[model samples]
Target: MQAFDLVSKNISQIIPIPIYVGVFVVLLFQVFPRIFIARQRSIGQSTANRPGKDSDTPNGIYDRKPSLSSLVTPDPTFSWRDNPQQIPREIKPGKYFLTMNVRKLDFNDYIIFDKRYLSEYRERQAIISNVGSARIFVAEANDAALDLCEETLMVTVDFLVTRYPSMFHRTERGVLCVDAGEEYDLVTRPWVRHPLETMCLLSGDDCILMRCCNDGVLRVAAVGLVYSLDIDWTSFVGKDLASIHRDARIPFYESAIQKSVDRYFLKLQPDKPVARANWLTQIGPELRNEKFPDEYFRHVSTIPGNTITPETVVDDLYFRVERQAMRKLPSMRGVVFKFHLYATNIWDLELEEGVPRRFAEHIRGLPESVLRQKHCLEYVDCILKVMDLMAERQEKNTTNFHN
Candidate 1:
C-alpha cells in the first residue's frame, strides 16, 4: 500500500491531477465510440465484398453473375378500330353554353394509339417543319417546368412500351419503335429538342404540363400540340388557367366555369383522371398541312369563310372531335393534359342512330358567341341544312325497316 501511494504521488507531480482527469474523460467519451464505429465499418465492408452465390453453387460462386429477372409477357393491345364497343361512341353534343364535361377515366384508356397514327404523325411533322417548332412545341424555361417535362416524358414512355409492347420494346440504352424503325433514348434527347419535344414526337397524343405556382394558380409549364386547333401553343406557356381561357377566346368562361375549373384542378387527386370532348368543323376533310395556312385557311383567299352554303358544304366539311384528358401528378402540384383527335366527314354522322339529328339540334341551340368561339359560325347554317336532310332519311329508313 505504501509503494502504490508513492507511485501515485510521483505521477501526480509529473502531470497535474486535472490533466490526468481530462485525459481519462477524453478516452472514455470520444475514443471508445470511434473505435466501436470503425470495427462495425470493417465488418460491413467484409460482408459487402463477399460474393453473392446461389444455394447450389458452392465452388463456382466467385465466377457467378447476377441472375436476370424473369421475362414478362405483354398484355394484349386493344384493337379499338376492330372493336366497335371499345371505340367510344361519338358524343351526342348537348347544351349551348360552355361547361366542364370532364368525367373520370381508366388509366388504360388515357391515351390511344389507333389506325390514325400515320396520318396524324405526317401532319404533325409537316406542321413542325413548315410553321417552325415554336408554334407546335413551346415551353417555359425554369426548374419546375423542366422537372415536370422530364417526368411527363418518363411517364409517357413507360406507358407506351407497356401498352404497346409489340410496337415499342425496351432496349439496354432506350425504347425502340419497331414500326417506325427508330430508337429513342429516354435518358438522352437530341441537342436541338427538349425532352418533352422528343416524347411528343413519339407519343400519339399531344402533351401539355401545368404546374400550380406560388400564387396557387395552375399555369401551363410546357405544351406540344400536334395541330393548333382552337388555341395556339405559344401563347399558353406560363399562363394561368384564367389567361388560357381568355387566350382561347372561350365564351362565358369567367362567368360560367372559371372558378369551378380552378377548384377542380386544385382538388384533383392523382388516382382520378378526367376527360372531355370538344368539336370543331374544318373547311375540308382533315386538310393536310395546308400549302398556304400562312396566306389563307378558307382554301380560296378571295372567297372568305361566310360564303360557305349548304349546297356548297357537302364535299367541303370535316367534323373533328378531341378526346382531352387531364390528370394530377403523384409527386408534384401539377397536371398533365393530353389530346387525342379524331375526325369524320359529314356523311359518316348519319351511320349512327339519331347522331345526325342530335348533332343538328345541338348546333341550332348553341349561342352565337359560343358558335363564333368554336369557329363553327362559318358552316353552322350549312351543317344544319345537310344534317336535317340526313336525319329525315334516317327516320324514313327506320320506319320502312320496321314495317
Candidate 2:
C-alpha cells in the first residue's frame, strides 16, 4: 500500500492530469465522428460496388408505336371547289333558310349564329361557327328553358364528330376536332350538351352576328354581297412572315422579354456608355475579346392603376427585356418577369390576413370570360406578368427607335 501511494504521487508530479483529459476529450468530440462517418460510407460504397444482382432485367415492356388499324382508316374525299353548297335547295314554308349574303369575310373572321333555324320535323336550336375563310363549320346547340329568355348555349363538337366526321382530323400540325368534352372542362356537365372549344372558332376585328338553327346546322354567311380577295402572285415572302409573327405577337411572354435585348449589345462597349447615350455605338475592347459579364439586365417600372394601388400592393409590373446575346438576332426572343412588391407600411396591413378581399375583387373584375371561369391567383399573376412584359417591350422599343 505504501509503494502504490508513492507511485501515484510520482506520476502526478511528472505530468499535468487536467491537460491530458482535455486533449482526450477534444479528440473524442472533434475527430471520431468524421472518421466513423468516412468508414461507414466506404463500407457501404464497397458493398454497393460488389455486383448487380441476377434479377435486374426488364422482361416484357410493350412498345408504344401506332398500329396499322389506327393509321389506315378510310375518310371521305371531299374537295372544297368541286363540292357544291350543301345547304337544302328548297326552303319550305315555316322552315327558315339560315342564309345571309355577307359582303366580305376573311381567314381570321368569326361569325356567330344568333338567329335560330327552324324545322317542323325536329325541335332543336344550334349555333353555327364559320371559322376563318375555310369551308369548315362548327355548330353549337342551345335549348330553351321553361322561359325562352332563359336559354342555355351548348357547343356542337360531338354533333360535328358524329354528323360531320369529315370535318375533323389529327393533322401534322394539330388536332382539328372540337372535342370539347375531352379537351376542356366546360363541357363536362350533363346540362351542357354542347361546349365550344376556343380553337374550333376563329374571329377577327369585324362585325359579325351570332346566329342559331333548329336542324342541328348553323351558318354564318356574310351580310350584303360576298367579296373574295385573291392574293397577287409574288406578294408573299413565305418564311419572313414566320419571323415577323415571332417578333410581334407570338403568344405568352417570351416575345415581350426580348424587346430590350439590344441593350446587351450596347453593354458590350467597355467604356460603358451613359444611360442616355447610344449603347450600340460603343462596342468596347472586351467585346473584341468576347468577354462579357456573367449576368446582365436592365430595369423598367410602371405603377398599377388606382384600383390595385395599396400601401403594400402587388407589384404587377412587367418588362420586355431583350435576349440577343444568347443567340442570333432573329432567334433571341423576349422574356417577361412578373413579380409583386409588398408595401411594408400601410393602414389595413393587418387586413391582408384572410383570403385577401382585394385579390378576390381583382379576380372578380377580369375582362375575359374564359379567364374568369378558371379564376386563380397563379393564372392572374402569370397573365399580368405577360402583359407587363409586352408593355415594357413596346415602350422600350418605342424609346429606342425614337432616340
TM-score of each: 0.73, 0.18
lDDT of each: 0.69, 0.26
lDDT of 1 by residue, 155-272 (tens): 6666677776766788986688676677777545333466666676678677788998888889999887766553466667888888888877888999999999999988875556
The numbered model that scores best in TM-score is 1
- What is candidate 1's CA lDDT for residue 306? 60
RMSD of each: 13.6, 29.0
Error of 2 at 143 (Å): 55
- Top model by lDDT, which number? 1
Please identify model 1 stretches exceeding 4 Å from their true place.
1-74, 77-95, 189-192, 229-232, 287-310
